[model samples]
Target: MIRNLLVAALLAGSATVADAAQWNFSYVASVGTISGQIDGTLQGDANTIFVSSLSGLQFNGTPGPALPFLASASSVVGGIPGPPALSLDGSANNILACSTDTVSSGCTSDGFAFVPAGFFAPPPVFFSGPAYGGAFFESYNAANWSITPAAIPEPSSWTMLIAGFGLVGAVVRRRQVVTRAA
Candidate 1:
């Protein structure tokens, strides 16, 4: 019985580890002399990025995207209304970061934007402007961002737990039968 319990405990612990969620994130940006944190999440497929929250964010001493723009979505290159070419470091890289053209249509560059695969590319910079279009652009080395994996269990984790319990029960029952025969 003690052996069975040990096995069950080991199985349960392993299940928790398997269910962990890895999230890569970074929120560092600076315009001129001011910089702040940008909060967001990257989808599992690496196709979409969502800016769920923002705080202490600014550009050249001006408040960045308003609160209403926080929950916006940005898609990959093949996505609809992809982003524009981004300027990182000193050279311009052709990566569709975000679209600042429309705000009401849900494709504004204020919040959502796409990053390259592996989430290693720099985040785009968005400046508040008119809904039609104005001074908005993407820069590679403008912001400080990081990707971190969150510890959240997936459905498979539950399955592992159940299977572990069943194994423990089976081992216990067999042990009891052997003891009775003796």
Candidate 2:
């Protein structure tokens, strides 16, 4: 009975630790709406979230860029405008480019280009409703965004969790046998 309880407890703890974080995002523009999934990671000791990788990106029913896009949000301070900022390369034509700015034009980069405070209201909030903005090349007038966390466990994490559970079970069982004999 004790062994079962111990194993269960250990397993539960491991499960929690094995969870990985993910980000789900979507945006709407006049040209069309784009939605996709991004692998997310927490920035160091801050209330900021970063998108490390992107996958399953679809823009207006077409496959989107696979480049890495970085996003971050700042809190409103002293009545100053705090908005979520996204960084990506832009082509010479001011079109959204790939991850790197130095990349050649028409390299199929992923990015956004807009004049600050030109279209959307001031102070864009993270994970909030649509943010209206003017996007060059495309008629992207409004952008709706959302962020979601995903849980993914690394292989090493699984291995360590299993090993920990085994160790804990062994210790608990040894204690139980000693108590019985005593």
Candidate 3:
């Protein structure tokens, strides 16, 4: 019984680790700074993850328009529309872009891109523009990108773990009492 409880607890704990992960990203852009959280499952390549959704996405320390759900990674090239190149690479070695409008409509409406070294041009590369074509587009110098994973276990997880340990202790204590009586 104690062994079964131990195995059950171990399996339950691993389940939470396998679920979706939360990645925090932040970068300074020409127009302003952008920061947000990406939630999704990591792909085979640890550096990339298929984006499921975004939260806390802000521009210049203020919230911006809602971004269209992206199917995959892409690029933000001078406010020009293009495919999702290496946008989702968390390593920051590739271009990372986000679109406010539907991806099908193009990134022209409103979007931001973070370009690391070895991009189309040299260093100091970033593309940003206003929403709904407000006529505010600029490529500024010096952009930084940081993406890291953050995880917090749920309260239920702790409760289950503690209960499992308690059960194991009770079984061991009962066995000791029986041995002494015999």
Candidate 4:
């Protein structure tokens, strides 16, 4: 019984160490504001996806690290007015506040983590819906974060080590119980 409990604990710890989140985004215009975004759902719902980074050349042609935030007024194409909402293909995150500093050297890449004030990345939505009659969810980023697809073994190793110790304890317990019975 003790041995089984030990093995279960080890396995649980290993599983957590083997997970990573991938962040992605899509660029859209002709239906966004320069301030807020309102991504509406098309078929009624959206699928959840992980996020990590944003890629592709931006509107201004500054190739490095495109818009970090999804469909911000400044991130949209053609530039819309302030407090605009970028419609989506599913249930949206319904943001209340959003802002980013200038992407120039020191200030650039400052804070990418979506934190308080209604900033966050919703799960991945399909590339459906049409903005300019094309792939509505235009350009964004899809960062795949895995356990290096290799370090995944580290967790298993830890589990084995712990389980080995537990086995030893179980053996010692059994011996004690047997001696007491005799």
lDDT of 3 by residue, 27-104 (tens): 655445677777766666666665566677787677866555453223433454433322344343333334545544
Give the C-alpha miss distance for residue 68 in model 1, angstroms: 11
Least lDDT summed over 10 consecutive residues: which range in candidate 4?
141-150
Q: Where does candidate 2 clash, by residue pair?
A: 20-152, 22-150, 97-109, 97-110, 98-109, 98-110
What TM-score against the true fold does each predicted structure earn? 0.39, 0.46, 0.53, 0.22
Model 3 clash pairs are 73-84, 74-84, 74-85
**lDDT per residue, candidate 4, 53-152, as tens digits?**
2334222232333334443223222233232232233222221111244422212232121111222223332121121122233232223111111123
Query: Which ranges in model 4 have alpha carbons more than 4 Å from their true place?
Result: 1-22, 27-63, 66-182
CA displacement after TM-score superposition, residue 123 of candidate 4 (Å): 25
Worst window of 10 by summed lDDT in candidate 2: 88-97
Give the number of the best model, judged by lDDT. Answer: 3
Measured by TM-score, how close is model 3 to the native structure?
Answer: 0.53
lDDT of 4 at 168: 61
**Candidates sorted by TM-score, best first:** 3, 2, 1, 4
Top-TM-score structure, candidate number: 3
- Candidate 2 CA-lDDT value: 0.44
Q: Give one digit per residue, the lDDT tens place, for model 1 in 71-122.
A: 2223333343433322222122222222344544544454433333333335
lDDT measured at residue 133 in model 3 versus the true structure, 0 to 100: 29
Q: How many angstroms is residue 134 displaced in model 3 relative to the true structure, after the best TM-score fit?
A: 8.9
Question: What is the clash tally of candidate 1?
Answer: 16
The C-alpha RMSD in Å for every predicted model, in order, reads: 9.5, 9.6, 6.5, 13.0
